[model samples]
Target chain A: MRPVLIMVGREFRDGLRNRRVVGTTLLMAALSLTLALLGSAPTGTVGTSALSVTVVSLSSLTIFLVPLIALLISYDAIAGEVDRGTMLLLLSYPVTRWQILTGKFIGHVCILTLATILGYGAAGVAVSFANGVAEQGAAASFAVMIGSSVLLGAAFIALGYVVSVLVLDPRTAGGIAIGLWLFFVVLYDMALLGLLIADQGKNITTGVLSVMLLANPADIYRLLNLTGFSNISTLSGMAGLSAQVMLSGTALVGALVAWIVVPLSAAGLIFARRQM
Target chain B: MTSPSVRLVGVSKHYGTLHAVAGLDLELHQAERVALVGHNGAGKSTLIKLMLGVIRPTEGHVEVLGVDPAHHAFAAVRMSMGFLPENVVFPPSMTGAEVLSFYARLKRQPVSRNRALLERVGIAAAASRPVRTYSKGMRQRLGLAQALIGEPRVLLLDEPTTGLDPASRQSFYEIVAEFGQKGTTVLLSSHVLAEIEHQADRVVMLDHGRKVADGTLSDLRRLSGFPTCIRIGLPSGVRFHPELPAGMAECRDLDERTMEIRCSDASKLDVLRYLLDAAVPLADIEIAPPSLDDIYVDILRRMAAE
Candidate 1:
């Protein structure tokens, strides 16, 4: 436990020190603010719907951005150390491979969580101030969105760890991580859209959407946030179906949670056997 | 009984068809300063990596601090060991202080002591600056500081002095010597034999992944059977006679006034008597033992001949 914390602490400090984190955070904040202001302008029905639209739009953005932040913070966690030769210094200590992996994961998770909270917090405040909905109810919705984003981010961070261990070079790992993110964030949805277009509305239903949600944690997070905002019950109502066919709240959350555990465990296994 | 800090029995490591280390046995007692010297591709790096648990041996066993480095228990062994790699490149964003503190945290110890270590290694002033700003020597010093971070009981340093300045190198050796006095067994690998000749208590010489010679410097010299060289400067007007002693294999006229003799045995008085009999007037004489380089070359030559 102590070693794990030590490793986590190191990861946290390193993340804070990284210029990439600072630059990414600033870029995210600027984009979030710009979107918040544009959505809040008093124009038409869109202006009145600004707060809802911003919340919904940023919810998707958060799904994409949170993981990007996580991967940026974590994809080089091990490979960078190996390349820099600092891994030798760290491994020379009396910490187990499991401890090192867990510690680094925890640390990265903390950083991702912090960035999500702060970046989303700023966006939420900007939208609320512009839309005049800075009350307790909106705050609660924002909290749920942020929580879901954190879970989503954790899944990606673990994925990044897997990438870090699997690839020997940081540049390659970064490219692969970003490429995977693009797949899940943009390409997966496009593929789903193509499938729906092919099915024309006859085959496109909540069951298929639920199955698609299971395939990507980012989709599940978006679906959860969407349900929180509106009465998307047709999607939620599928819960009454058989346990295996239906995606329960517990199961959706569990699958996202599994995303956090399995990849990290696999990375630990690989790292333990790695020569350096 | 206290176990050896490091022990390797018939250890061998192979990379595909190339054997990096072959059938080697070694033990490092507590506080012993052992120097590993070999030419490139001689397996010195492989041996250090095996000790650090970075690489597993293909054959035989390696125990570091009484724990098998290949097992999970190796973590405990590594916790007490410090390693300095040959070429150290740190994360560009990390400050020196942050780097040290992070390593300290990874070791699960307070880093209050690391500040002094940073200062000791002469990088305390630049602790706040990112490592990108540090020169090669500074980076090497930082590597040394990180290696000393938990006051490790066992230290494996590979080409530790690669970029250090003379003053820093001197201080670095002093620090290593102090660690040795504190009972920290140090396994240092270098191609610079003379630099470590006086510092290492035992020297292990490797050639093509095999332990060609292992003992004190003098022991290796004696084993090589390299002849000690003597230079005799004859008085300006004297010339050498045709007849020379049997043991003296080669004689070269260094100058019109001087002749140098290569003798198998320098202690014999017959060579001098023969020079005297030939009316070779000698002005000054110098006798020097074979250096480590000479002995190393002789060993390699003898092994090749065999």
Candidate 2:
């Protein structure tokens, strides 16, 4: 446990030294602030609270941005070390492979946490100040959005590690990470929409659709942030689907946690068995 | 009488159809410096990896500090072991001090000691500089410093001085020698046999993933059975010839006033006695034994022939 914590400290410091922390935090903050400031302009006409409107816009933006930043930072986590021949020396230390994996996972998740909280938090605070006061329920919904955004980033980071350990080099890992991002965040939905169109709601009921959404972490994140809050759900147009979907917010968050654990465990296993 | 610091009993590592190591048995006593000599693909690095437990042997056992490295308990044993791999690298964004401290914390050693290690490796002046700004030699020195952390009981260095300058290599060997005197078992592998010839207590040669030769320098020289050469300098323009002693001894004129005698180790003294008895005015006499390089080549050639 001491060794694992030591490893985590080193990795986190590495993230700082290499600008991974600052770069990601700034990228998230800049983008979220833009969305928060501009996307909430329609609240004046829609009669919705400015913060809830910001949540709807931010959740939509996070589904694409957070995972991209997460994958970009994590795709090379293991493969880069192997390619640089540093992993050989690192492995020769007293730490176990699982400890190394766990340390790196925690370290990277911390980076994402910092990025999501500070990034979206800046946006949330700005919107509240502009709107004169924060509503109790809307503020709670905004907090959940920030917390779940970090979870969503963690899930993708875990997926990136799965790719990092499986590949021989970072170039291949980078290519695979992008492919996974497209498949989950973009192409999977397009394919699902195609399937729904082809079925014409015959065999694919809302229940099956909800279960299928659980398969991709991105959709789970979308469900958690966009539909978990009543006011935000109405604003995001997910109110109807949220009512029909049997999964509660806890179940969705659990599924996201599972997304993080399962892939991260797989990464640890593959890393342990790796010859180098 | 104490158990060997490291022992390998019939260890073999196979990657699919290719055998990286094949039925290797070896041992290193406390404080002994064993130089692993082999060409690329000769399993030198593979053997180190097996001992480090980063890769498991397909067969047999590897024990370091009395614990099987591949076992579940080896992580504790690894605290006392240090490995410096060939072409070792660190994250470029990290300063040299940060790099050493990072490894120090991982080894559970005090980071405060890393300052002395940096100075010992002659990299203290550059300790605060990012690793990316360092030269190859500086990086190699940093690698050695990290490996020396915790004063590990077992140290494994694979081609540790490949990029070092001659002076740096000299200091590197000095550091290694210092550690060896402190009772640390060191197994260093290098293609530069001449560099380690005088440094290592014993030499182990690998060929095709098998141990082909293992012995001290003189022991290998004797086992090779190669002749020793004696060069005698005579008076200017003295082109005299003399009958050599019995046994496998050959005499030939190298040039005017110089004659060379090649004789087996057993007959070397006999030939020298004959030279003194002949009353030949000898200006100089130089005896050269078979070097490790020559012996290594001969051994490899013999293995190839077999």
Candidate closest to the true structure, highest lDDT: 2
Query: What's the TM-score of every candidate structure?
Result: 0.88, 0.95
True contacts kept of each: 0.81, 0.98
Model number with the top DockQ: 2
Candidate 1 local lDDT, A24-72, one digit each (tens):
6677677777777875565345223455555666676787788788788
After the best TM-score superposition of candidate 1, give how far the Cα of residue B145 lies from its true spot, in angstroms.
3.1
The weakest ten consecutive residues by lDDT in model 2 chain B span B239-248
User: What 10-residue stretch in candidate 2 chain A is worst by lDDT?
Assistant: A39-48
- Root-mean-square deviation per candidate: 3.9, 2.1
lDDT of 1 by residue, B58-97 (tens): 9999998888986777776666788988898777778899
lDDT of 2 by residue, B50-76 (tens): 989888899999999889876778878
- The number of clashing residue pairs in each candidate reads 2, 0
**Model 2 steric clash pairs:** none
